[model samples]
Target: MAKAFASQGDMTDKQISFTEVGRDLYAFTAEGDPNSGVIIGDDSVMVVEAQATPRLAQKVIDCIRQVTDKPITHLALTHYHAVRVLGASAYGAGQILMSDAARGMVAERGQEDWDSEFQRFPRLFQGHESIPGLTWPTTSFTGRMSVFLGNRRVDLMQLGRAHTAGDIVIHVPDENVMFTGDIVEYHSACYCGDGYFADWGGTLDAIKSYGVDAIAPGRGDALMGQDMVNTAIENTRDFVHSTYRPAARVAARGGTLKDAWDAVRAECDPKFADYAIYEHCLPFNVARAYDEARGIAHPRIWTAERDMQMWDDLQG
Candidate 1:
């Protein structure tokens, strides 16, 4: 390999921020790392998107403790990404939730993803030794499921495919606040390695239909108010489109992967070069985009070896 993935060189810890998106609803965000959401209900609490490792999860737990002593009864995962799901043990919630498609993905490529991500970004897995194994959902749903923490209701729905085949968003009706996982990012780059580019835009539209007042996005700052929320949604749409268009154009001409890479960079770099994880995600994103453009509907599973091989090919 000519050089390590960009994430591999990111050893510095990010500053954590626990921002309140609504009453009793919080977003746990790092500088640009994976984020978690907290919803404190009448009696218990529900957490969204566990961090990468048990140690990382503890930080979100600590933030939750400061606000409420209520036990976390539900842990909802939006998808099956290793970085978001491997920390399940830390929550120790009796009921863990994921979409049926997400659970299926876990069975298909969970271990491979864990190995690939662990190798790509060691910093995210600060306590990799403590991870029990691949996180499994005790309960799985097909489209939408509603869980009530006493009186407050948290609706988990699979809007459409975006970041992954089974991406769900947690919506709180009373507050009109939604916890969108990697489906909608604020300032950070969307990791589209396992994404469905063709269906992503429709999924974004589904999320936009709600017109929620506040959104605890997958990364970056907590979006509060309609203006900020709309801005993030559109920016995310732009990022996804910018990345796919050029790659698709290259693929349409039966161009090489390297050709698609250059075209994508030419389009995306000017706007997203400074975005967090932009470099780390570009090659994988381009490869996936190229594949999707060439008629691959399902994303190819990413393994540790494949990560290196793809990186080498792109670098060459």
Candidate 2:
């Protein structure tokens, strides 16, 4: 059994479920904040995603300590997000793994992303000083990598470009559970500033092709059964379509950004009123969807200054 160290925050949401999905696979979730996957092998452990800071990750690490003494040998990054990867040192894993696209993004706009995400959610970055620097994987794979953890088999695959140009999923064969990074969010608002709405939907379909029984999505509680998993996927799909459709329509009509934003808000806000970070993500999501519909395949990088400018323009 694993135990978690709890923390307090404005969200007032606290959850530490050490549910065993398979024989040795477990999920450590904190409500819908940021969930991490734990793969315990006979000799070592591979923590799928390290939280924002070591201090925050320690809570998850403390829980892992209760179950096994096997050193955390590997840390896998699903993508390049300050809230997700900056806390790499805490785990102190022997190796940090990511996809080649992730590394390229780090080399390109890691700092800007750090600033953007920090501005979006300050609570996730509790210990600002602890971040030694941008997190980089020691080893990076181009598309996929298959690894065996004792008797457990993990198939890491990058099916398409959704969350980012380079996104990966950790698939556990025995458990039939897929640990989707930000590629598939449960109830939380899917941040689309750097996302491809159409491609994101296609990626969701790609994920379903694996025939997963459960999914530990990027945010929100883990999907338990295939039905719940399908619901999550469907919700994500519907949200993406709802957001992009109006943005596309407004752009085609040569409306201002505010007009485009208004169009989507009327459609999405009511439906996704209770979803996580809906307000925080709405402006950025609308901005990006507007551009994507205008034929911008890659999203413009977000810097601190650019973020403020966009926020002022859209939010104000």
Candidate 3:
């Protein structure tokens, strides 16, 4: 089964690939499922964003082996999204890294996110049995950390929150490449349930400041070159704006939740009809946006059953 992705459809079954974007900077992509990044340093490797399970993470590990035999010394999660972080154990990294806000979110709603995402997208959770539990970062930083892997410096910075309260981006200054975990997606759906819509655009801008030549976002193919880089940032901005702002406006106008959904769809579907998983992100996006508009600070927990009920209600 070869892995592939539709802008909006079931992800294809495939083995996945680790594409080298620059010197020692590789992107391990699993069809259209969430992506993982590997930075091969002089002596060791740092993997960013583990897959859904160890079996899945091992698949990425095997790909990393093809490039170098460096032991994975660290697994750096960009945020606390279950689909993105659950595969940490497979990396065998003695040190797992994340943000303070991310750790808080895990303590807040990690279990619910685990259940909610599992039910929402089962295919991505391909070896669910292999998952030990929620992925936790042993080393968490507030803003930034500079890791010197034998002099190949990599900067991990929490530029600003967008996709979540704790989204982080990895910058390899030498290669001028960035691994943005869902902060900026290229041509794929921008998962925005826990995202701050207005802040997302700025985060994209913050990511752009690195003058990234290549970027491997949370989903979709890696963005290569400056032109594609610009497109990715703008596309993510568009998705966040299109989905959340309209829903927020409608929710504020005393419109029914269903009305907010309709308004969001009408505004987004036309512009983002070609984006990957646009439909999948809609119901959750609306629910979150409605909450935000109504003065909810933190996003409500989403259980599997509640996910279906919300989807059913919105889709109806």
Candidate 4:
């Protein structure tokens, strides 16, 4: 029998975990679902990665209320993916920030991504009607920008490209804790459909140089302690490398997309078969790697139509 299309069959609700990675920093994670980070400051808070919709984002808000009653003053989106930004209205944050590249993407292909993702995983889009529209940042930055919540400083930087061309990491200098958007993931598949395979590792290296005490990764459990942080970063590196190498090899041999898919599975399945969203991400990852290996510098925009077509072609 043919496999279910992308995460459509994953209807079961995941248990949510709100863990404090630092004194005032928290990670709101739901079993491999897109995670959100909370940074509580002296008088306000800044949130990273809004969930898919208003209803979903409210869950993060609920989690935030449990810890502190600080008003959410900033919403910093790390990228332009629909799942990460569509919930902007729910936060009621006065300032919404993104990298310039990310804001550009929102203007270019944000709706296509929104439609594509909504179809790929219906469960995540619960209360889709509540989404006001495509999320646009009130402020856009270049390399790095800092926000001061009273006296505490939070640095948001475009370290390098990994998950997307505009990925950013949020660092808390006081606690030495970082909220790495999708640039780093723990025990979860890196969704590389729009990623730069060649630049991902260097981005990981940049993140490693910080030697952070704790990290609330894009997904999976909140990483606490240097050892756990290091393990997740290296594992993410291995996952990216393992997926790209075999697909690149197949492309080098002038192989078909299906051929590249098979090669990547052979190389990645043994190690990452049990990872969250591994199966859902494999086909897109292989497709992007194949394109990159064939000298495609930029990833093509994914629409709902393209999503179905690609799935049909690969799963056949």
For candidate 2, write residues 237-281 as lDDT tens digits: 999999999999999988878888999999998899788777777
* TM-score: the better of candidates 1 and 2: 1
Q: Which stretches of candidate 4 lie over 4 Å from their true place?
A: 1-3
lDDT of 1 by residue, 77-122 (tens): 9999999999989988999999999999999999999999999989
RMSD of each: 0.6, 5.4, 3.8, 1.0
User: In terms of TM-score, which candidate is strongest?
Assistant: 1
> TM-score of each candidate?
0.99, 0.94, 0.94, 0.99
After superposition, candidate 3 runs with Cα above 4 Å error: 1-11
Deviation in angstroms for 309 in model 4?
1.3
Candidate 2, 310: how far from true, in Å?
1.0
Rank candidates, lDDT, best first: 1, 4, 3, 2
Displacement of residue 186 (Cα, Å) in model 4 is 0.8
Report the lDDT tens digits of candidate 3 across residue range 1-316: 1221122245567557678888999888755678999998999999999988887788888888888998999888999998889988888899898999999899988999988777677777878988998777899999999888898999999998788999899999999999999988877788788888767778888888788899988988888899998988887887888788888888778887889888888998888877767767877788888888888877777887787677667656
Could you tell me how far off, in angstroms, the CA of residue 167 lies in candidate 3 after the best superposition?
Answer: 0.8
**What's the lDDT for all of these models?**
0.94, 0.83, 0.84, 0.94
- List the candidate 2 regions with Cα displacement exceeding 4 Å: 1-13
lDDT of 4 at 255: 97
